[model samples]
Target chain A: MTSQLEALRRELDRINEEILKWLNRRAEVVQEIGRLKLKQGINRFDPVREREMLDHLVRINTGPFDDQTIRALFKQIFAASLKLQQKQHEDALLV
Target chain B: MTSQLEALRRELDRINEEILKWLNRRAEVVQEIGRLKLKQGINRFDPVREREMLDHLVRINTGPFDDQTIRALFKQIFAASLKLQQKQHEDALLV
Candidate 1:
């Protein structure tokens, strides 16, 4: 059981690194979008797009997780990306 | 520019799926850990361990995101996993 636990923890550590990599990748895309939107004078927040993304995720979800929990987690991720983009935008303006 | 935006959005979609997979993987590990802790009469929360994880992440973090933001993101991930484990524990109790 201890060995099993150790293996699981090792897997968790690997997953954490994968998550960090994906998050940074996502952030890079989000920042690019932010820049494009600014250039086009488009709105920063798009509720319709966000909703569509969530709905797509729900349709694709084959869970050990329910749809609601999936939505919640994705929303948190979305919010983080949004926050990162916003911060970048602010910094750009300040410069 | 529009093509670039579309490409970026596609990349974001791919990253989103990767994040979902990792999050689920992390959740499974957390659940197993929760079970082990319960069986061993160990405490559910471990502040020192959590701090060590965060500190390790900080030491390894590479740019575009500061230590604070990385810590915030990891903490959010940790909280979600904890909530998942608690719910599983509750359900196990009811059974």
Candidate 2:
């Protein structure tokens, strides 16, 4: 039998891969949003929508991780996506 | 034709679901690690390993998100996981 730590590590590796895939998918959506926002002359950041999302996540969290940490993680995700969107917009401007 | 924003929002919704799934999976693994650590009398927090992970992430990141933000996000993840492990250990001790 595999050691418990080894098994757990394997699971973590699998989940990390899945997270990477989802992050990339999210980035693609952010790029699309950036394009649309540029066309509409809209700001990329939407604090109200982000707050709504965090609230939703808080409601649904049945966690080993607490609310504050969950919020922090989601905020990082949002910040990363926003940065990705901004980069896409800048690249489009240059092209 | 679907408005670009609406289509992008749909994609974001799909990706968010995937990300949520992966996060939960990661949490499960973290709990397992907690159990193993408790049994082995090992500390849950491993700063060196975490640093190695952040370094790997930095090397692999091709991002609009800078290295500092990536490291920060990973630190949050590590902290959350460490907390989860501690909680598990406490619960098991009480059982």
Candidate 3:
């Protein structure tokens, strides 16, 4: 029983680590998108793209959480990516 | 050594769960703030409050990541919470 519990705990740890790794990768890609938006002089907040991404995630999601929650999570993610890009822009100006 | 590792892993998992619970609580407050803003006819984006939160988070952060990263993370979180509030507003309007 102890060993079984150990195995399950390890599995959860592995999954959590994988989730964080994927989140980092997602942040990197979003940063790239922010750079593209900056280069094109487009608004950081793109409702159309955001809506599409949320819709896609909602359609594909089958999980412990609901679609709205997932969409809300992603929306926060995009906002954070945009802020990072903006910070980079400010740093470049200061330099 | 395996037992020690198991203990550490369980600790991290517990921390992760606590973090998620706190996030939910934060979202609830943000929702309340959103409704108040609507009632008083205020903007959703409050630069002063946001800047203050980020600054506080950065000041309090002590970790593997830098202050900027911490601030960036919180900014994303606030954005997500705001999005949830906005969605709630829209739902109310639709009904």
For residues B12-66, write the lDDT of model 2, one tens digit per residue. Answer: 7667666766676688788888777777878777788678767876777665456
**TM, every model:** 0.87, 0.81, 0.50
Tens-digit lDDT string for candidate 1 (B4-68): 77887788777778887777778888988999888887778878878877887778777456678
What TM-score does chain B of candidate 1 reach? 0.91
lDDT leaderboard ranking: 1, 2, 3
- Candidate 1: how many backbone clashes? 0
Runs in model 3 lying further than 4 Å from the true structure: A1-95
Give the lDDT of residue A82 in candidate 2: 85
Mind giving the per-residue lDDT tens digits that candidate 2 earns over A1-95?
24767777777766765666567667767877877788888877889878977887777776656678778888889988887777787888899
Interface RMSD of each: 1.7, 2.1, 12.7
Among these predictions, the greatest DockQ belongs to 1
User: In CAPRI terms, where does candidate 1 land?
Assistant: medium
The total of clashing pairs for model 3 equals 0
Which residue ranges in model 2 land beyond 4 Å of their true spot? A90-95, B55-68, B93-95
